[model samples]
Target: MVAREQFQVELSKLRGDIISLAHETEKLLEKSLEALYNQDIDMANDIISYDTKLDQKELKINEDAILLIARQQPVATDLRRLIIALRISSDLERMGDNAKNIAKSTIHLGEEHGLTIHPALTDMKNIALKMVDLSIKAFEYEDITLARKLSELDDLVDSMYGEIIREMLEETATNPQKIQHIMQMAFSARYIERFADHTTNIGESILYLVKGETLNLNE
Candidate 1:
């Protein structure tokens, strides 16, 4: 059963690729949050370095999917999984870009003005980070229940984003000098919100992978 052995080998490689990308995503989020918290330019700059690795991994994931399809002609569920791996890796790469964007914005804000960090946004960051972590676990375990739950949890981050935006607008309206700094803060919050959305997308992808039914986190 040489064919069977070959299939197993490829499957193992695919799983390895998925796990590596997941770990990379976690590191990206951690660095982004640490940069923001410390207002460290060097840490912000490091995102660009790590982004190269992410790009490479994305390319490998796509190439591997194509090879798997061409060689195996995987049917039904197997085909769906290969497709999901390709699709979800792209989403994960975009999430990493958003994390980079947040770090860049933090650097600019720190350089432009001595802006005081808002403690409340910490809640939103924590929520987004947790979402990413749980989404990975959901994928690794093929947990449909966790995928469904993640869909509902996104609203918590969304609500906090809205409230933070309102507070910033009110403050900026009263003090024109705060406009630029507040805008940077708003962008950072938006990045975190978008990050949460990507994580939810991963959750949805995992659900689809397991159940073959589309699950939208937006609902």
Candidate 2:
């Protein structure tokens, strides 16, 4: 009984640590997107630099979770929870990495041409940020309803991405010099789309926490 209680405490600790990592990664992504929107290369650079800190936190969380699993050999449900937490941590870390990649692209684009960003793309960017924010909120609060709504918001970002892609393709045809610049902008937009996807993944993770079933919003 005493050993079981000890294992429970370790599991709780691991869960808290995982949530912390998730929150930090979300912050990194938020700053990265803001840097892109505002054309703050310095802010983007800071976000890129901090991504390594998140990587370290993820490594530590992985080690701690693994150590607990080996030490406790948690039973079926507990094992599942731990595994899900590990997967969520991995996903969050990768999201941070993606944000860093987008920041680099933002810097490149900003340097090449003073961005003549369309208002429509700005709306798309805002929606992407909103989805990510709400997804994190849903996870922290375990609000399945909020998670469901994020799926709808993500669709808005998807539509914006499609519009921008088509516009860029047409622009490239008319003025070939703009191709490389627009392509980088398109890539930045693509990263945001993927970021929203990751946000939905977080929502799915929260759903799994509540229902013990996997929900893949992307599918």
Candidate 3:
């Protein structure tokens, strides 16, 4: 009984750690997007530098969770929960990496040509950020229904991405000299779209937590 209680305590801590990582990644992504919007070179640089913190947090969570598994030898649901926690941490870390890439693109798009961004990017970013928020909320509650909503949100982002690419390519044809800026904007959009996919993956993980069945919402 004592061992079981101790294992539960460790499992609770692991869950808390994973939630904290998601929140941290959310903040990083928000700041990076703001930096991109405002074209703040210093802020973009800071976002790039801050990625190491997310990396370290992910590593610590995995290490602690693995130690618990080794000591407790958890089976069935307990083991699955710990395993899902590890997957969530990995998705969150990759989300952080995507944010870092967006920040880099923001830096690359320094105010050289008096750039005016596409309206589609605004729509795309909004949906992507919403996915991040909703996915984390779903995970916290283990709400399978809420997790399923992510697929629709992911679809919205994907649609906007296609529109952005089409518009940018057309604009590039006219302003051939600004091809480099166009590429950076396109890459930034791709990064955000990719992050949204990762967020959906998190929602899928949370759904697995609730239903004990894995569903690939990405498809």
Tell me each candidate's TM-score.
0.93, 0.83, 0.94
What is the descending TM-score order?
3, 1, 2
Model 3 lDDT tens row, 1-219? 366888888888888888888888878878887887798999999998999999999999999989988998988778878888889899999999989998998888995657786667767777887888898788777788888999999988888899889999998999998999999889989988998999999988887777778889998
Local error of candidate 1 at 182, Å? 1.0
lDDT tens per residue, model 2, 100-175:
9878977887754755754565676567767766876776566889988888887778888899889888888887
**TM-score for model 1?**
0.93
Q: What is the lDDT of residue 16 in candidate 2?
A: 80
Colliding pairs, model 3: none
Give me the candidate number with maximum lDDT: 3
Each candidate's lDDT (Cα)?
0.82, 0.77, 0.86
Candidate 3 accuracy as lDDT: 0.86
Question: Better model by lDDT, 2 or 3?
Answer: 3
- Full candidate order by lDDT, most accurate first: 3, 1, 2
